[model samples]
Target: MTRSISLIPSGFPFLDKKWGGIYRGGSYLVIGPRKSGRTLLALQFASECAKSSEVCLYFTNMRPKDLMIQAASLNFDIQSYMNHNLLVVVRIASPSEIYDVPNPDDYLAEYLHDIVAVVNQYKPNRIVFDELTPYIGFRNIDYLNDVFLKTLEEVEDKNINSFFIIGEPATQKAQLIVDTLRHSVTGSILLKKKAEQLAGQFYGGTVIISPNVGHTEGQFTADYIIEPYKGISVEPTIMKTFTRNDSESEERLPELSKIFKPITKIKHENIDDMQMNFSNIYSIEDFHLIINNQIALFKSTGQEFHLVSLKLDSSAILKGLITLNQLKNSVGKSVQKKDKICIVENTILVLIAKTNAHLLNEIIKKIRINLPSRDEVYVKAVTEFIKIYTLEISNSFNNSAELIELILSEEATNAHLTLSELT
Candidate 1:
């Protein structure tokens, strides 16, 4: 019996889309505007979860005792939950109290040490630190980022979820918090007002994420919702593209084919276009290694100058940049044929030779016949990889200084032929 396993956790669109399942294990941030009930929401969630014998720790930099008061207002049973020690409510003097005194950076260092120590000792499944903005204000957002990264290192499993709440008009400082945790936390929920209904009497709250609104135009969107609870109905729930699965993620979106056409070419540009001087004869260089090896055989053993470029499109090269070392080695005998050169235009190009060119070509023709219908398989892969592009460029382009170099490299691959300015 065999099965496919998803390394990603599913069902929660907001967190699932972002951290996949890491938030369940590590930490997360739930951010919204003032009076948006961010704290109330986090407490309600932590309390309700505590009932299931899940140990949680709610560390408050402000009023740890006021949790009962806040919970009472929200109709949450946090007091009873606190009584059983199922939840630990630690009231630090200030959010900054957890850190060292005098020097703000020193405070951050001490605060992170305390946090890690507490989390390790309790090993709680859920941890909620009421508001990080205050701490961030005392020190700096950059320092907070390091704290968050260190905090994530302590996270070991998924069933455990951490919620870090922040009140936001989305300040640069607050944005730094959002951006930092967006990476370290499992998922991020950006709460925004969709629109006002009944002349602004009621409004909708929307949750936007990066991967969900990610489209091919190199545009990533912030998707969310707006609602008045019972009065105003927001279409598509209030989710844009999130890491978690809210109630609305039940229905599946249409297949990739319905949205975008599949790409036939994976690498369209010639090496010359990549600034390689193919015109100038070179003896030994990394780019020419493959051709040089072949040319050497033809020179030393008097083999033919069999130079050929095979057009392997996206499907054939989806595994590009990712080495198929073992897979390629398995087919060594298949690819090593004398007096043969193949050109592939579509992705799945296989040329069989010695005497079976006719048969191989016939088989390939049949596969191409089914290409247009199955184009979506390629489109979806490329789409998800769109987010990974930054990582890919960093790994691939050594010459380029920043992400723009990678963008240019990918664009170079897409454009194939360039203008005089590039020259």
Candidate 2:
């Protein structure tokens, strides 16, 4: 008979949406490089479980006092949980502190025994082993396996959910240790710095190496940012796009249409007969309608077009460095009559029809030349001050909203143009 496993919230919207929460009694491995926010993620999970009245045991090398303070800094109410007996913080000594003692193996064995004893006493519904690296390095593979297996068996017997946080392996022995533990766990998550540059900065991402509940085959990755009060927040747009299954494409249209429902429902009587005016700057709502029509036309005819965005620093405008009219005029003079301009917040969205990347760069250069700057010093800092992001819209995109969302997310940087680099 198949075993029935309960489910618990992951405390993250993106993760919960992707996997429908995690298995109640399952154990997972969360591996990441130093400062990649692995501990914070695990802490967030434990805190959320505690909030729901589930008992949680958090084991870490740091002092319990210090760990509680750190959790509070991230706005996690760890102290309240502790007061109510919903959360227990255990302090495990660092390997360096215990390795110097006589019969260090005996000390390690005693530590594992105490932890198991505590679990049997408290019967926590969730457990976390933070930074298992020190123990992995303290003993041989056999001893390490013995310690890990002992704890895993206890948790499994009690049907307790667990998370084992470890640093990315830097040596062969460490890799072997991690690999062995990985197979025994129900699933694994890898957090690391993004390899590619996004907006001139390397962002962090979380990859579901093996999910226990849903879509277990293919890997899913999502970008994330760490904040003081928020802990780790995943970018919802990228997560929604990347983690969506291909089979659900048919159901996604109506949901995507709702993103721009207000703009689409507007009645424009002579939209088709509208004269082309390159110098005219359109509002955000009108621009949305035009882009939607353009995208629909491309879907039916298979013709491609380019969407370029000139993102300006709002601080520059407030500081009297440049005026919106001056920037719009500069951009207007560079494009042909077929191109359309839309002002969205601090960005100027341009629709370039029947254009290629080479010609796009030429137009960008002309716009840069037309921009009014005080002197050569200001001209040299144009690239540093402003950003140019471009995306080529093709039949691959389902709707205009999706394309516009991708551009707004700043992920469509395949053909980004730097103003200073342009001759």
What is residue 154's positional error in candidate 2, in angstroms?
1.2
Highest TM-score: which candidate?
2
Model 2 regions more than 4 Å off: 1-3, 97-106, 194-203, 212-218, 240-423
RMSD of each: 24.2, 21.9
**Shift in Å, residue 292, candidate 1:** 99
For each candidate, what is the lDDT? Answer: 0.41, 0.66
Off by over 4 Å in 1: 1-23, 62-66, 95-102, 138-143, 157-159, 169-174, 193-204, 209-423
How does model 1 score by TM-score?
Answer: 0.43
Error of 2 at 272 (Å): 68
- For model 1, what is the C-alpha lDDT against the true structure? 0.41
lDDT by residue (tens digit), candidate 1, 275-392 = 1121222222332344445444544564433121122234322333111221122122234333222121221112122224354334333433322122232223222221111112
RMSD of 1: 24.2
Per-prediction TM-score: 0.43, 0.52
